[model samples]
Target: MTGAPIVHTASGPVRGSWRDAGTPNASAAYLGIPFAAAPVGELRFAAPVPPEPWTEVRDATSYGATALRRDPGGTLIPEPPIPGDAILNVNVFTPAVDDGAKLPVLVWIHGGGYTEGSPASPWYDGSRFNRDSVVTVSLSYRLGFDGFGYIDGAPHNRGVLDWIAGLEWVQRNIAAFGGDPGRVTIGGQSAGGGAVLTLLSMPAAQHLFHGALALSAALADIPADVAKERGERLAGILEIEPTLAGFRSVSESRILKNQPKAVGGRKGLGLLSGLIDDGLPWGPIVDGELVLRPAADALRDGIGADKPLVLGATDDEFTMVADRAPRALRVVPSTALLRGVLRDRGVRRAYLRANRPQRAKGSAAMVGRFVTDHVFRSLVVRVAEARREADAETWVYALTWVSPTKGWACHCLDVPFWFDGLDRERVSDLAGPNPPQSLADDMHGAAVSFVTGGAPGWPAWRTEPGTARVFGGHPQITTTAYDNTLALL
Candidate 1:
C-alpha cells in the first residue's frame, strides 16, 4: 500500500506510482500502458493489433506518445502533445490495486474534432474519480487521416477499431486494477462525445461498454461515397494513388498538412457556412460494415436500446466564436445572416421566432447561437427523440453555466466540472476565479451517480421527451430545454 503498486496485466506487469500517498484520497496511477502495438509502418492504417508481451516490469509513471504529432495551439483543454510512435496507450487511475474492489469504470475519450486531441491533458487526470471510488481511464487512438480517412485496401474506421481494442484490454485486465469491466461507462465531449454515441450504436461495440455519456456530441456519419470522394481528393492533392501503398509512401506530416485541403468547401466567411452545411469532414463513416448507418438512425432502430445513456450540450456552445466579428455582425441583420445558413424562408422565420432572446442580443450573438443550436443542441434533441420509441433509458442535461471569461456557456465549459477538476491547471482561464464548487459538486456528482448507478438523479428523457437537467440556471429541470432547436428541425 505504500510503495509503487504493481499490477500484473494480461500483457505484462506495470508498476505505477502513488498520488497523494499516505492520504485518504491516495490512488494508484498507471500511465502510458500500451494495449496495442505502435500504429506506424504496416499497422498505420490497419486495425489495432495486440501489443507484444513483456517480462520486465514496465514503468507506468509518465504519459506516452500521442497520436497528435504536434501541439494544436489554442485548444480549450490543456492537451499537451507528447512525442513518440507508440500512441495507442491508456492511463488508469484506481483507488485500489488488485484489492478485488470491483469499482465501476469510466473510460474517457478526449475531443479535438476527430483530428487533434491528447490523452495527456492534466484536465483528464483521474485523481478525482479515484477519490470517489471509481476507476478512471483516458486513452489515445489514431487521429485525422490515419484514423478515419478511407483508403483502398485499408480497413475502415481504424480509430474505432482502436477504441474497441482499448475496451477489450479493459475487459481483460481492469480487474487487476480493481475495476468492474461489467459496469464500464464510456463518455466524452464534442468529437469524443460523438465517439461515445458512435460506439453505443455500433453492434460490434455494444458488449464493450454498459452505459454512455455524450456531452455536446458531434457526429460525422460521413456517407461512404463522400468519404471515398474525400479520400480520393486527398490522394490527388498529394499526387499519389488513392491506395494503401500510396498513403504509406507519403509521410505523416505530409498527410496532416494536406488533409484540410481535401476537406474542400469555401473560404473565409463561407467557411462557417460550409461547416454548418457539410458537417465535420473527418470522423466515423457509415462504411456499411463497422458503422452500418448513421448513429441517430441506428438508435431509432433500437440499437443500444438496453443501455442507460446521458447526453446534452451547453446552452451557447460556440457563441463565443461570434464575438470575434461583433462589429460586422451588428451591421448586418440577424435575419439576413439566417438567409445564408437556413435558405428556406419559412424555416428561417420559424427559427427566428423560437429564438427571440438570441435575436435581441444582436446579429453576432444570434448567429453564434444558431451555430451552437445547429451543431450541438439540435443533435441532442434528435438523438433523444430517436431513442424515445426504442424505449432506451436516457437522461439529458443542459450546462447553462456561463463562463465568466468566455461570456457564454460555450463548448467545453462543463468538462472540468463533470470531472470535478476545477482545481486543475488552466481551469481558471475558462471558468474564471471563484467558479462555484457547488456547481462542480452538482455536475460531477451527477456523472458519478450515473456511472455508479443507472440513473443520473434526473427524469429519463423518454419519461418526458425533451426534458433535461438544467445546470448553472435557477430552474432544476425543464421540458422545453431544446424548444428553440425544434424550430430548425
Candidate 2:
C-alpha cells in the first residue's frame, strides 16, 4: 500500500498506482494490462490468443491502445482513441490487494456502435465502484469491419471472442485483485450493452459472468446472407477477393474508408429509412456456431435463464437529433413522417395512439421517439417478455431524468448517474451544471447492490410483468414504463 501496488497476474506481475491515496475512497488502479496478444500480421483477423507471459513487473500506469484508430468527434461519451498494436487489454480497479477479501466484480464494456469506442474514457473510471468494494474492469476489442466483417478464411465474431478472452482472464486472476470471480457482472451502454446481452445468450459465455446490465442496447444480429453480401461488396469496392488473404493484403485505413459504402450510407430521410429498415450493419452476426441465434431468440429459448439481468433505456434515447433540423421537421406532419419508418398502418395507428403525448410534441419529436422505441425501448420489453417464464429474476428500469441543456432524457444521460461519475470531465456537456448527486447515489447504489447480491433494489419483471423502476425527478415504480413500445410488438 505504500509503494506502487503490484499484483501478480497469471501472465506476470503488474505495478499499479493508487487513486485518492490516503483517503477512505482510495483504490488501486491497474491500467492497460493485455488479455490477448497484439492482433497484427497473421493474427489480425483471427480469434484472440492469450498474451505472452512477462518476467519483469509491467507498468500499468497508462491506458493501452484502443481498437479505434481515429477520434469520432461529437460523441456523447469521450472515447479517445489510443494508438498501439496491443489493443486487446483490460483496466482494473480494486479497493484492496488482499486475495482473501473476496469482493464482487463489475466488468464494463464501452459503447460506440461497434465501429468506435474506447475503454480509456474518463466516464468509465471505476473509482466509485472500487470504493463500494466492487473490483471494476474495462476492456477493449477490435471494432467495425476488422472485427465483425465476414472473410472466407477468418474466424467469425472475433470481437466476441475478445470479450470471452477478457472474462477468462478475470476468472483466472481477479482473486489476486481481491475479487470474487463467481460474482462477476457484465454491463455496458449502446453497442457495448448489446454485447452484454449477446454474451448472456451465448451458451459458451454463461460461465463468464453471473449477472448482466444492458443500457439502451442495440443488437446487430445480421443474417449470414446479409453479412456475406456486405463483405463481398466491400471487397469489390477495394478491387480484391473477399477472402481472408485478400483482405489481409489491404491496409486498415483502406478498409475503414470503404466500409461505409458496403452498408449503404444514406442521407437525410433515406438515412432514417435505412436505419429503421436495417439495424446496425456491423456487429455480432448469427453464424450458427458460437452465436447460434439472435440473442432475444436464445433468451426466449431459455439460454441465460439462470442469471439475473437489469436492462432499460432513457426516455428519449436519440430525440436530440430531431432538434438539429427543427424548421424542416416542423413542416412535416407526424403521420407523414411516421409512414417512412413504420409501414404498417395498423401498427402505426396503434403506436401513435399509445404515444399521444410524443405526437403532440411535433413531427420531429414523434419520429425521433418512434426510432427510440423501435430500436432500444422495444428491445427492453421484448427481452423482458422473452424471459417471463425463466426462473432467474429480471429487473427493468427507465432513466427519465431530462437534461436541462439537451431538453430530453436522451441517450448517454443515464450513464454518469449509473457509474456515480457526475464529477467526471465532459459530463456537464450532457448532464448540464449541478446535476443531482442524489440520483447518482440511488442508481449507483442499486448497481452495487445488484453486483454484490444478484438483485437490484426493485421488484423483478417476472413478479409483475411490465413493472419498472423509473430513475429521474421523483423516482418511482411504473407499470406502463414501455406501454408505447408495446404497440410495435
Candidate 3:
C-alpha cells in the first residue's frame, strides 16, 4: 500500500499517485483517465465511444486536456488549460486504494456557463471529500460550441451526453477505486448546476446516479433558433456552413478566435458575462429527442421523479454584476425584458400586472438584485416546486454568507465551502482569508450525508410558502426562499 497505487479498470490497469503525498492518510488520485475515445477527426461531433483499450497501465496522476474554449478573464483561482484531443477524462480521488472500500461517490462537473471551464482547475481537488470517506470524482466535459451548439449533423446537448458517458464509465470502473457505483451523487454549480437539472429532466441520465445536488442552479434554456443562430454565426466567422464538417475544417484555435463575435465581441466580462447577458447564448437545446422539451417542462412532466434531489442558490447570485459594472451600465431589467421573461415562463397576466414596475432605475446593487431574482433565484424555486408536485424528495438551500472583501454572496462564491476547499489559497482569496470553517463543515457534511444516505440532513420541500436551509451567519430552515418572487415571475 505504498508507492503509487495500481488498479484494474474495464479498459486496463491505471497507476495513480498519492495526492497529498507524505500527509496523514494521503488520498490516492487517479487523474486524466480517459472515459471515451478522442472526439477528433471523423468522431469530432459524434456521441462518445469507449476509449481504445490500453495494454499498459496508463499514468493517471495529472489532469487531461481541457476542451477548447476562450480564456475567461484573470482570477486568483487557477484554471489550468492543457490542450489536446483526448480531453474527455475524469479525475478520481479515494481515501484508500486496493482495499475494496465501496465509499460513497460524488461526481462534480465544473461550471463556466456552457462556453468555458475545466475540472483541471486547482479549486476542484477532492482530497477533502476523501477525508470524509467519500470517493470524489472531478470531470471535464465538452464546453462552448464543441459541447452545446446546434449543428446540422451532430446531436444537441453533446456535453450532457459526455456526462452520461462518464457516468457509464463509473459504473464499469469506479469499484476498483473503492467507490460504490450504486451510491453516486452528481452535483455542480451555476452552469454545471443547470446541467444537473437538465440531466434530471433527461430520461437517458435518470438511472446513472442515485442522488443529485445543484448549487446556484441557473435553470435556463435557449430556443432552437437561438442555438442555431449562434452556430450559424460561428460558421460564418469560420467562412463555412453551420455543420459538423464545416467546424472540423477549421482548427480549434481558429474557432475560438471567432467565438467571442457570436456573443457580442466579448466586451471584457469575466467568465461568460456575454452568454449570461445574451440569455445563455449556448446550452441545452430542445432537440425533441435528447432534451424532449425545455428544462422546466421536462421536469414538471415527471422526468427523474423518483430520484432524491437538492437545489440551492447564493443569496446574491448575480449581485456581483452590480459590484463589477458602473451604475449606468448595470443590468436593470427594462419593462420589455421583464415582461418578456414573464411571458415566456407563462406567468399569470394578473400577477405580472400587479408586480410589474413602470421602469427600474437604480444602482448596481438594485439592478443585480432584480437580475438575481428574475434569472437565478426564481428558477431555483420553480424547479423545487416542480419536484415537490411530483411527490419527490427535494431539499432547497441558499448561501447567505457574504464575502468580507466582495461583500456579496455572488455566483460561484459557494464552491469552496461545499467541497471543504476553504484551506486552499485560491479559495481563501474568494471566501476571505478567515472564512467560517464551521459553515463548510455543516454544508459539506450535509452534501456527504445526502450522497450516502439519500437525505440532505433536512426535511423534504413542502408545498406553499416553500422552505430552504439557509447557510450563512445563522444557518436554519426558513420559509423565505423566494419572498413572494413567484408572483412576479
Candidate 4:
C-alpha cells in the first residue's frame, strides 16, 4: 500500500502513482477518482448523484476532466486543459494508503471566480501536503451556469451540492487512504474561499469539515434579483424558457458557446475581461433557500461558531488589475476622471470616503486599493469580526510578501507558497526564483498545522497581542494592520 499506491475506496480499488519512483516516504497521488456520477445529458444542471461503484480497479494515475468553463482572458497563472465527462471527480494525495496512519485531511476547492478553474491545475498538485503527512483532496465541481445559475427548472447551488457529495465521499472512503475524515479542513482561494464561508453558513455543511481556511475569501453574495436577471438573459440567448427542461434541452456545447455573451450581456459589467470590469455573471447567490443570509449574518447567528477558522487576504489583492489596466488610466488618474469612470454613484462615494487626506490621491494604487477592499479584503475582515464576536477560534493572516519580480503582492500570489509549489517552474515564475524557501516553509507549515491540529501555531485573533500573522520574508504578528482602511469601508 505504501510503495505501490493501491488503496480501496468505498466504491472500489484505485491505483495511484508515487511522486518519486519507488521511495517509501514519497506521497501517492490518486488522480481523477469519481466521487459522483457524470453530470451529462439528463444530469446536466441537476444536483450531483453518487457515482456508481466500480467493480474493476480504476486507473487514478492522471488528472481528471475539468468542469466546462471558458477563461475570458488569459490569467497570469497557467492552467492546463484536461478533458472528459467525469468532471465530478476528486484527486487524493496521501503519505500512506493504510488505515494505520489516520492523517488529517485538507479538502481544497479551487478558485476561478466560480466561472473557471479546476482541481487539475498543476499548481494544485497535493503531493507537497502529502509530504507533510496530510491527506489532501482536490475536487472538481460544476462551474458557470451549470454550477450557480438561478434557473427556473434547476435547484440552485448545484455546484455546492457537488462539493457536499465529494466531502461525503471523503468521509466514507478517506480512512482507507490513511485520512481521518473527522479532522477535515475545507479551504480554497477566491471563489473557493467564498465557498468555504458559504458552506460554513450551511446547516447541511456543518460537521462535514471541522476547521476552515479561506484565502482572500470573496464573500460577496449575488442578490436574488441580479441572479435572476443573469439567468433570464442566458435563457433569452438560448431562445428557450429559463426552466430546467428548457436548459436541459440545450446542448452543453451551446450553453458553453453562448455563456460569455450571456455573462457579458449585463448592461454595464461586461465580464472580467480586464481589471476595470469587476462583475461576473455567475457566482454564489443568497437564493433564500440554500444560503438564507449573507455570510457575516449567518456567522453572527451562530453558524460555524464552534469551528476553528483561519482567513486572510494578500495586502494588494487588486494590484494585478491595476498593473494590467491601460496606462492612461492606471499610471495617473485625475479625481474627476476617476469619478466619471466610477459608474455607480454609491461606489464613487464609498471610494471618496474611503480615501483619506493622508493617503496618495488619484492614482492606480488608490483605485486598486478601493477595488481590493471592496471586493475581497473588507469581507474577510467583516467575517473575521463576526466570527470573533461569536467567540469562534479564529486566526487571521495577510501575505505582505511582494515578489521581487512581480513587484506587487497581487491576487493569487500566495497560492504557490501555501501549496509549497515553488519548485514548479510556473510557480517559480509567479513567486520569483530564490523566493524565500523559509517563507514557503512558514505559510505551508501554517496551512498544514491548521489542517492537522486545528491551530496554525499562531495566536488567535481574540488573544492579547490582537495580531494577524503577516507572512513574508520576515513574517510578523501585528494588530489591526488594515483597521484604518477597514473602518472606512
Task: List TM-score per model, in order.
Answer: 0.98, 0.98, 0.90, 0.91
State the lDDT of candidate 3 residue by residue for 1-489, as single tens digits: 567798898998999887667676678889999999888988887888999998898998878888844356554345777878899999998986555778889999888777778888767888888888889898888877788888998888788899999999998889889999888988988888988888888888888988889987775477777888889988887889888888888987787777767867654334334434567767788777787787777778788888888988887776665567754555543444345334554553443443334123344554455567666887877888777777777888888888876778877888888888887756766788899999999998998889888988866776444778889945487887556367654
lDDT tens digits, residue span 218-277, model 4:
764777888888788989999999898888889887887887686664321112233234
* Pick by lDDT: 3 or 4, better one: 4
Assess the local accuracy of residue 411 in candidate 3 as a C-alpha lDDT between 0 and 100. 77
The local lDDT score (0 to 100) that residue 287 gets in candidate 2 is 97
Model 1 lowest lDDT segment of ten: 265-274
lDDT of 1 by residue, 289-379 (tens): 9999999999999999999999999999887777777476667999998897799999999999999998998888898899888889999
For every model shown, the clashing-pair count is 0, 0, 0, 1
Cα lDDT of all candidates, in order? 0.91, 0.91, 0.78, 0.79
Off by over 4 Å in 4: 1-3, 21-24, 69-73, 265-279, 331-334, 337-362, 464-466, 473-475
lDDT, candidate 2, at 116: 91
Question: lDDT, candidate 1, residue 159?
Answer: 91
Clashes of 1: 0
In model 2, pairs of residues that clash are none
- What TM-score does structure 2 among the candidates reach? 0.98
Q: Candidate 3 — what's its lDDT?
A: 0.78
